[model samples]
Target: MATDVSNELDRADNVGRIVDSLDSRRVLLGALGLVGFVGLWWAGSTAQPEYILPSPLAVGLAAQSELASGTMQAALFNSVLHWLPGTVVGTTLGIATGVALGWSRFLDEALTPIVRVLRPVPPLALIGFAIAWFGIGHAGAAFIIAIGAFWINFYAAYGGVEGVSEDLLDVARSLGVQRQLGLIRTVVLPASLPEITTGIRTGIGRCWMLVVAAEIFGAPGIGRQIFRASNSLQVDRVIAYILVLSVMFLLVDTAFRVVQRRVLAWR
Candidate 1:
């Protein structure tokens, strides 16, 4: 009788696991959502002139043409060279500054005022400085992106540390890790990871938005490509570039999610 009961329980657990599996209903639902979205877009385009609202196919064709002409490649390379450097510089500096401020009361008090004053200013507002300093090239574009990324990571790191529980610090102390660096590594850093990751993800999207604007400032990139297309009234190319930009951002977001899941697998 006990053997029979155990078999029944095991079968029930297996059934539950199958039902809760990720690729089952979740994949189906996600596919359905994409279909519905594209269907709505198709309907909307059908109701408008192709020039005003190009169909997905039209944009795809434009993308093909751009790729064939090497326009897409050049623009992508130009944008990447600057955007990547800026993000790296910004994220690194912001995290370091934020951690320092969070860990030390003196530093927090000394820096908070200046950070607050600068934080409200938009990257666009700093274009003059960027151009003056970097001479309207990749360096200028990178500087703009860096300014945006810095703030995001800074707040992420700062808030993550601030949000760590006092109990966690106590636990670290009890573990005989009383030094500041040890406390950060053993308690504060781990405890604050979720918030820090959130900040990085948020920054990724924000930086992409800024990319177009940053590129508009005499930089040779996707933004310039779109703008130049508009000069000749090539709305199809404009739409295609917009689609390309969306795809790029989506890819980055997906990659970040994958990395995030792996890093936070413990949770």
Candidate 2:
């Protein structure tokens, strides 16, 4: 028993060491890559005029000016307001529908073909229809964003549910947990959580993409700012907005990762 305990402790120590090593490696590699990218950008910018390709400092100054003017904040908030509601509603509905379809062959067969037909059509392709139907406002942008978020989440939830182990189902049955709802609650949900989390992450990314497109096409948001900057030949401001969007995406991705780690701690 003492030997077994010692071995277990040694194994745990090895795992901790491995995790630490990997974390350090990742940080080092990421920093190196970032430095290379910045060096390249600086070199390229220096090779051209500010109007052609602004220096990083120039772009930073432009961003600061926009922030000080409050236009950047207003545009960012508008985009977020449009995106948040649609993403929440669409993701929730998609997950619920996906779970139901995955759990029932009859439902899956009925809906799969329809979804397949709709899924291939890009959200941007439907913008004209959105404008006509919802009229180039928050509603239209939200609708477009929802469409993008829905498909990603639906497939993720479906795949996750379908991937649950048959042995888990059998074990639940053997334990006299005979109700379908009980099985879903006790076994299916827990088993499929990781995949669902992945889908939500993907959906969030899609929402960002859609927000830019929606704003570019007459919706009031950051994409509009980008569009205006481009049209007016304010390349530095355009690049600044792009940088801001990229930063937002990074922050959202990090937030999701933290939430996933906490929520799926058992895994």
Candidate 3:
């Protein structure tokens, strides 16, 4: 028994080492792939006009300058102002509305056609309405962002609720949980959490992209920074601003993933 235990311990240690080695290899390969991409981008930049394809070094320098001057910070702050309220409002409304429709057969039949008809309308088309309704400030930009988030979250919640197991719900009803609200609160929400969380994650990313489009008019954000840079043919600055958006997205997504893992730990 002692010898058998020793052999199992050795095997486990060997497996752990092998897993660590694989993880390190994956990290190294990812680094090399990023280097190769930068090399190709440098070659492309050399072949094209600087105004069209600024070199990575030049873009890095521009990013440094923007950071030193505090312009990027200001733009990022403005963007957050637009992004937060819009995402929250849209997400809350969408989830609530979708849950209602999904829970009620009568509402689903009566409202789904309207949803289908409205779903095809792009957020860009509503830019005019946003401006007219909220003016050309943060509210207007947020309206556009909200619209984009609304549809994404709406579909997610609707699908999640729709996909809840009938057997599970029936079991809950038989257990003296016949109230619709009680069933939804205790059973449906938990069952559909994964889909709802996925929708929320997707909406978060989508909303960031919309920030640029939302600020295209007169709103002050990273999108406006890009516009100003492009007008002067400041390709390096444009690329730098784009990198800023990429970095922000990565940071936010990473933070959210941590929360998601905790929330879904039971799974």
Candidate 4:
């Protein structure tokens, strides 16, 4: 037993070392890619007018100014106001609805057709209804973002539930877990968690992209900042806000992935 345990530990240590080496190489390559991209951008900016393509330093200065003036902070706060609520509501409802439809033959039969029809409708197409219903504010922007998140999560959860092992469910039933809710809670949900989490991660990224579209009709956010700056020929400011959006997405994604790794540690 001791020999087996030592062998396992050694194998695990080797795997960890390999992973760390790969991660280090990945970081180095990523840094090189970023440097190449920045060099290209600098060369392009030097050839173009500032109004057409701002230099990296100009965009950085603009970002610093926005930060110093507190406009960026306010915009970030407002963006979060809608982004958070929309993502939460959409993810919750989508998972519930998807699980129901996937688990129940009747619901699947009744709703699959309707879902197929509605699935292709673009969230942007709802901007008019959002304006009319929620009226040019955070609520309206959230509605649009929710639509985007809903579809992504819905498909993810539905597929997850569908892919659950029949043998596992049968084993649970044989063990006296017969209640529908109990079966779902103990077996179905745990089995489907990976796909559901993947959906959530994807939904988060898509919703971030939708933030810009959501704010197209006059909501206050980074998207609004970009719009306003673009209209005034402020290319530097526009690039600055775009960078802000990129950084925010990276931060949120990194944070979520950390939590996801912890949650799925058993895997």
Candidate 5:
């Protein structure tokens, strides 16, 4: 029995090693792919006139200059400030509303029709309304971002809550968990955490996309900076802002993944 247990343990160790090796290989390959893509971009841009496409080196230098002068910092701060509050408020409201709608059949039925009617309208389509309501400032940009984040969280939370097993519900009810709030807190919320996290992640990505568009319209952020750069024919600066935005999103995505792992540890 001792020998058998030792053999099983060795096999398990080998499997773990193999999995780690595969993960490392994936990371290595992804890095290589990104490097190759940048190389190709650099080469293509170098082959073209500066007016048409700025070389990666030029863009990198511009980005460095922007950072050194603190313009990049200010733009990044402005963008984050607009995005954070909007995301927080929209996500909170969406989750609460979604929980209510999913838990109550009558509420779902009543709201579903309205949501359906409004859901198809793109956030960009409401830019005019946002501007009219909030004026041309941070609030308008935030409103646009919020609109995008809200729908994402709403649908994700609703689906997650609706997906909870009826058997689980019955079990909870039998175990003296008959209170709706208690059931939601103990069972539904925990069960739906994974989906809710996914929705939040998606919303984060969407918020970034919308922020640029919102800024282009009238909001003061990275998007506005990029737009100004483009209008002034500063191709390198424009590319630099685009690269900065990409890096910011990557960092945000990594943070979200970390949070998801911690919050859903039970899973």
Candidate 6:
């Protein structure tokens, strides 16, 4: 037992070391990529008018100005307002429905057809209804965001739970856990959690992508700000806001990864 524990610790240490090395490489590569991208932008701007394509320096300056003006902060707040609620509602509902469908034959039979029909239609395609119902504000944007996230997590949870091994359930049954609900809690959920978490990660990224389109209607957000800047021919502000969106997504995704690693630590 002592030897086994030692071996396990050694293996964990090695995995940790490898992960650290990979993270370092990722950081270095990301920095190099950013530098190359900026260099290209600088070159492009030098060749063209600022209005057409702002240089990296011009964008940086505009970003600083936006920060000082606090308009960007307000936009960020508005974006998060819808994004947070939409993601939460969508993920919660998706998990519940997915777990139900995966566990219960009746639910699967009842909802599968409806889900199939709805799944292929992009959430943005429902923008007309969203605007008509919610009148193009934060609620409308959030509704659209929720629709996108719902399907992502829904499929992830459904497939993940359905994929849990029958052998695990058999063993649990032998141990006197008979009810599907109890079995779900004891075996299925934990076994399938990695996939569920992956769905969450995907949902988050999807919501970010949809937030832009969601705000196309008069909703106040970074996406709308990007649209406004573009209309005014303020290419620098548009680029700056686009960078802001990227940074926001990066931060949120990184946070989710941390939580996911902790949740999946049993693996």
| Top-TM-score candidate index | 4
| TM-score for candidate 2 | 0.93
Model 3 misplaced stretches (Cα beyond 4 Å): 1-25
User: In candidate 2, what are the lDDT values of residues 67-170, reduced to their tens digit?
Assistant: 99999999999999889987997899888888989898999999888988998999889899888998888888988898888888888889999999999999
- For each candidate, the alpha-carbon lDDT, in order, equals 0.87, 0.90, 0.92, 0.94, 0.89, 0.92
| Cα TM-score per model | 0.88, 0.93, 0.90, 0.97, 0.92, 0.95
> Candidate 1: where are CA atoms >4 Å away?
1-23
- Deviation in Å, model 2, residue 218 alpha carbon: 1.6
- The predicted structure with the larger lDDT, 2 or 6, is 6
> How does model 1 score by TM-score?
0.88
In candidate 1, residue 181 scores what lDDT?
92
2 or 4, which is superior by lDDT?
A: 4
Candidate 4 residue lDDT tens string, 152-265: 999999999999999999999999998999889989899999999999999999999999989998999999999999999999999999988899999999999999999888
Question: Residue pairs in steric clash, candidate 5?
Answer: none
lDDT of 2: 0.90
Q: Write the per-residue lDDT of candidate 5 for residues 1-267, one digit (tens) a residue.
A: 999999998998999899999999999999999999999988898789986888888988999999999999999999998899888878888888888898889999988889999999998899889889988888888898899899999989999999998899899999999788999998899889999999999999888888899887767779988999999999999989988888989999999999998998776
Error of 5 at 25 (Å): 0.3
Candidate 6 backbone collisions, by pair:
none
lDDT of 1 by residue, 190-210 (tens): 888888888888888888777
Could you list the CA RMSD of all candidates, in the order they appear?
4.0, 1.8, 3.9, 1.2, 2.6, 1.5
- By TM-score, is 1 or 6 better? 6
Error of 3 at 44 (Å): 1.9
